[model samples]
Target: MFRSMLVAVDGSDIGQKALEQGLAVARAMEIPVHVVHVIQTAAYPALALSDLPPPDIAQQALLDALYREAEEILAGAERTAAAAGVPVTTHKQLGHPGAEIIALARKVGAGLIVVGSHGKGKLGRLFLGSTSSYVVDHATSTVMVVRCEPGAS
Candidate 1:
């Protein structure tokens, strides 16, 4: 029943499970899979210092590194999907991971959005935040959360 499936991957074990599930669903439905990795920008406080170069320069450098990492993550996802004989496209975005994934799902007209649950307990999530929680809460499209327990393949 899905026209397209969007998989949000981050190179984690849980993310790998999500990719596998997304690919499986896409393959069964004979639909295309869109793999997306978001480069979350580090939050830095604005500093007013005329003597030194702008902080944006450093931020840009960090972003470049993150972009490279994202590309690597996407490449691995592509390979997995390819090995599974699933049609796949990859995208790299810069912003909040949950928001970007939702936006891309909308843009790509994805019938399903597949994501991995980190399995962080409630207190941990309360302090560290959770992307899957955000996506589940904010996304309009159907979402499937694949939960991979620690030490389980």
Candidate 2:
């Protein structure tokens, strides 16, 4: 039923599953999908590293790396959609993962958002929250969470 779907990927195993699920939904609905990857900046407090000054060259290098990674992710998604015979578009954003995802969903006017519940670990998630949870809490659009079971090859 979704006309436009926004899928978020973080290059994690779980994120890959989310991509697969999102692609399936998009294909079934016969709607175009927009795949987005957010290059997270400063994920956690670097109490020790914070003492170091931000280097211009390092910042530029980080940006370049992020862009390259984003392009690869989008390319993979594009190939998946192509194989599924579904229409697809892509975007790459550099910001807080949660905020960027929500913002892009709104900007795209997507009817739904598909994201992974967590990016890493299996049982470790019992303590930490996931991007999917964050998006579900903050996003205005409907969110679909794909739970990628651990050890699923």
Which one wins on lDDT?
A: 1
Least lDDT summed over 10 consecutive residues: which range in candidate 1?
Answer: 42-51
lDDT per model vs. reference: 0.86, 0.79
List residue ranges in candidate 1 displaced over 4 A. 42-56, 150-153
Root-mean-square deviation (CA) per prediction: 3.9, 3.9
In model 1, the Cα lDDT at residue 5 comes to 86
Q: Write the per-residue lDDT of candidate 2 for residues 1-153, one digit (tens) a residue.
A: 677999998777777888888888887787778999887765523312436566467666766776898898888878877887777888988667778899999998998999887445545545754577779889999999887676552
Q: Candidate 1, residues 73-129: lDDT per residue as tens digits?
A: 999998998899996899998777899999999999998999998788799689977
- Work out how many backbone clashes candidate 1 has: 0
Q: What value of lDDT does candidate 2 attain over all alpha carbons?
A: 0.79
